[model samples]
Target: MSRERKREGALYLCNQRQRGEEGKASGKEDEREGETRTD
Candidate 1:
């Protein structure tokens, strides 16, 4: 039971990290678009 719980925790952490990276990527894309628009 403990091992299963640990696995779930690890999976959750990985998912959160991936989500954070995706958010950062989208934010960078938005910045690029804004810069191009201003130019």
Candidate 2:
């Protein structure tokens, strides 16, 4: 509702999104490793 609160909320959302992206990247790396093992 307040401007400061809005800024904090945005920061929190951005941090959460960054974490999700990192998780996805790590998962992809693991899949690549599995493929390499198969090859």
Candidate 3:
């Protein structure tokens, strides 16, 4: 992936972590976001 997508993905990880939620559900959500981002 390009630097921008990596940066944005990192930002999303940080944002999700900041929300104080973790584990399987968030993982699935992140995957969905990544798919959406690709679209």
Task: Show the lowest summed lDDT stretch of 10 residues, model 3.
Answer: 18-27
Please give the clash total of every predicted structure, in order.
0, 0, 0
lDDT tens string, model 1, 1-39? 999999999999999999878878777876788899999
- C-alpha TM-score for every candidate: 0.65, 0.61, 0.47
Candidate 3 on 1-39: residue-level lDDT in tens?
699999999999899787756545467877788899999
Error of 2 at 13 (Å): 0.3
Local distance difference test values of all predictions, in order: 0.90, 0.89, 0.81
Candidate 2 wrong stretches, greater than 4 Å: 28-39
Worst 10 residues of 2 by lDDT: 23-32
lDDT of 3 at 35: 94
